[model samples]
Target: MRTSIVAVLYVGGWALFAWLGDSWWQLLVAVALAVVFTQLGFLAHDLGHRQVFRTRRPSDIAGLIIGNFGVGLGWGWWTTKHNRHHANPNHEDHDPDVSPAVIVWSEDQVARSSGLPRFISKYQAFWFFPLLTLEAWHLHIASFKALLQPTAKRRGLELTLLVTHFVLYFGLVFAVLPFGKALLFLAVHQGLFGIYLGCSFAPNHKGMPILTKEDELDFLRKQVLTSRNVHGGLLTDVALGQLNYQIEHHLFPNMPAPNLRRAQPIVERYCQEIGVDYLQTGLVTSYGQALRHLHEVGAALREPTREPTR
Candidate 1:
């Protein structure tokens, strides 16, 4: 398959770079590796959604190999989390992606916050991209933690693959490069990996409406209203892994990445016919909208705390 061939090429490239190690230029390889890992993540996403394979068994096998072995991400854990996000894209309560953690997504969450999270929420919009540099580490940690949970399926297998990936990955870097350069390589690679991956997903639903229990809506409206699409051509499609068409992707989660673009016009027209709001914007505009929303949500935190009038 084409995907398999491309994956092989990426691995070969990494091997070649590893062999040619001990130069500052390896930092560039780190950048390329970050992009490579993100592409693997996209492929894993497709496998998770059964876009590539008809049966769950084949999909799970490929997902585990590509996700855990290839990208050092736990496929089981990611699928569990991602499935919940798809089931409820922007639901403040149900969606783990939007749930109050480091950054509060909703004003209600802002009220309940305290300590470090509260401080972060105050200027989350400003801190958003910078914070994304750590997103790779966050995901890696979360994946390991998920494997320890009782609910994790195939715990042994996933653990083995994950441990092996870290071992081989770290061993290779430290083996070939000096300790200083290895650290530098890791910083650049993981930081850019997180930023690039975060950028790809951020524009999908970040600025869109957040739903609550009281806000009842049908499936069609729920997905279309909460999702935003980015307008671009082939380059954009390849870069974002077809995620630029978030509305169509959300509506048809199992749709192949390539087909999502084809489905976009038809989906857009139907939404128009039904008088549903179809949100789409350019890439930079989409980030601006998301950041603006974050700023607006954190507005209350920016106000000086009032003292009791006694």
Candidate 2:
């Protein structure tokens, strides 16, 4: 039923785009498509975690379809990277999520930056939300790059589906709309889609504990401490793709997305009983915490240099 709903909305959005001629409403269609695409992306995430199917093969097949073809991201690449993140949620060394790029999550990573990156790191917290507008395109590019590498797993199938996706996606847009409208459609769709994706995932671990190579903890503790739950009712659940239950989802990666809500109370009680710091906050609050953390890490760069005494 969930999959059916997602398919309908996604296809309907595309159909609406095809149906609309030269009009300002195409931009609204772009927003609608961005939303539906993000939902499909969450479904793809579930498939990658094998939470949607009983066996690995079926899930992988579904992931390839929903993730690669529907969403234009490589399922194999995503799964490999995501699994490593689960194994070490916020560990600087192992978790690709925290590996420094545009924004530094820790002071150590901020210190390591030099040249252009160093300059950027100083203002990264301010730029984080804005930069997220490009994240979907970034992931798409990363997916193709990873799949094209010789060492990538399931390279052939992933590449094929991804290529097919771009062909159909661009083909439909360009065929139906004028060049300028096509450009606007692509820009709005990809930009809003990326922001939606980043907003959903960043709050999960951004402000939580940062683990290092030498740090070790039990699985439960590690997952709980490094994850934050966003508080809202059903709307939040649907918007964030059940990821509002981040602590529960991280603790039980293979649990079905629908089941995460039910598991939240149990997980929260368990954390309380065990004396773990289970963080839960409103969406705005969580974003603030994440940005504040980013700002704090970048503080050294933002500091003014003192004048030398004569």
Candidate 3:
């Protein structure tokens, strides 16, 4: 019930902003609501895995409703990709989401022969979201792919959810508010939400070693290899939707964002006992580091290594 209420509040807030709201303060409120919807992505993520709500039916309903209504993320596809990512964090083949988002890894043989090309490759990638609005690109591509997916036909709710999303978005974009103001509100709101999602998610797993299949022989091993946490102050936490604590969240997907701090010590001890490298950093320092590491990811991918189990 709480989750459902949260979902409604998110959409409701968006509606309020899209209609009568005005000024920078209202824009911030809209951004906050959008952030809530974005964070709902994480909630659905946990629920999809049945780690949040536990009951399969309830969790699935929660995930599907939030995913479709709040973020327009295809629940099935997101789950497939996310589970695979957990199973194989950075394996080039198994983990399709092993992003080139930032040039964080070291360059390999392929990049060495080239200079400007190498730099450009990394530079363009690091700026993927910021430079050219890759969020828009991703949404378009993902929407198209999901719509055409044969599996989507079997997963009947996808189209309904997407159409509802369109109705909501378009209703705000055209029917509800004045066109000019609505576009402006949507633009600012999306900008903040996009940065929020990208910063929170990209830094979570990006700089971590893109481990191979063999590295993730077990669940515990995969958690250690695939995940790390970031810690920042209250403002950063609020802005990033408490996702700076990425490693902790990954380890305990069911835990709400607000409780991560209290859970940190416990998670840290576990990481220590397991000998896991609990990667963590504060806002500015880690922010700079994440950017640098993103540029070097392509470099890391190319290092010579024996193949692992696929």
Candidate 4:
């Protein structure tokens, strides 16, 4: 209901602005759209978790609409990946989120990295935000690749909706704006969307513990120890889609975003009783910790390469 209202408003508002025609000022609208896109992404995430719908069919239907149709993300692919993250949190072997890629998350990953990734790891903390500008494009590419796989579920529907999204999105932008302005709008819109979405997810588990198969942690400990919550009020809650309460969210993945805040204290108290370390920090500090972890992970790369002794 509330999400429907927001979707209507976003579509109507975007249509109104597009109808008004191209102007340099539409870049501002692009910025605003980026924020809304992040919010919509969060909503899609909740849908994937079945927070909005208890049944699998309804949740997948809504997720496809919000993710594939609305945001050009592949619902099937994202949910598959996200569910694994939930099952394992930050497990080095199982969690896709922390997998070795552009940024190495652990020392073992650093050792495996070579070429560009290895070089980039040395300065990843500094390049983090700038690199996020490409995150949206990376996601889109991954979605297409996933749909192309033979094992992809509902491959036909996912591919059709994803293709339709690109056509409609590009067609609408080019129809309303000059080529140059349209390109600028896309750059700003996608770039900021990536950054905002990345920022929201980064604080949750980036700097927290990275688990491996050797670490035999209970479900509660695995989720709690590997997630960090950000401290803030209403504005932060809205901006982060209540992901500020990451510990609570991880523990209760299906809990609606609104209820995470209410669950926080209860979760925290239980953690206390069990002697688990509940990490909650300010937003800025959370990012700092994440960045510091990135830097620390790359520390070995930053060292002088040792020459082999004959």
Q: Estimate each model's TM-score.
A: 0.96, 0.96, 0.76, 0.96
In TM-score terms, candidate 4 sits at 0.96
Cα lDDT, all candidates = 0.90, 0.88, 0.63, 0.90
lDDT of 1 by residue, 137-207 (tens): 99999999999998789999999999999999999989989999999999999999999999999999998
**CA RMSD of each candidate after superposition:** 2.4, 2.8, 5.4, 2.3
Candidate 2 has its poorest 10 consecutive residues by lDDT at 301-310
Tell me which of candidates 3 and 4 scores higher on TM-score: 4
Q: Which residue runs of candidate 2 sit more than 4 Å off their true CA positions?
A: 305-310
Question: Candidate 4 overall Cα lDDT vs. reference?
Answer: 0.90
Best first by TM-score, ranked: 1, 4, 2, 3
Residues 143-182, candidate 2: write the lDDT tens digits.
Answer: 9999989999888888999999999999988888899989
Which residue runs does candidate 4 get wrong by more than 4 Å? 305-310
Q: Give the per-residue lDDT digits (tens) of candidate 4, residues 107-178.
A: 888888888788888889999999999999999999999999999999999999999999999999999999
Cα deviation at 106, candidate 3, in Å, is 5.7
Q: How does model 1 fare in lDDT? A: 0.90
lDDT of candidate 2 vs native? 0.88
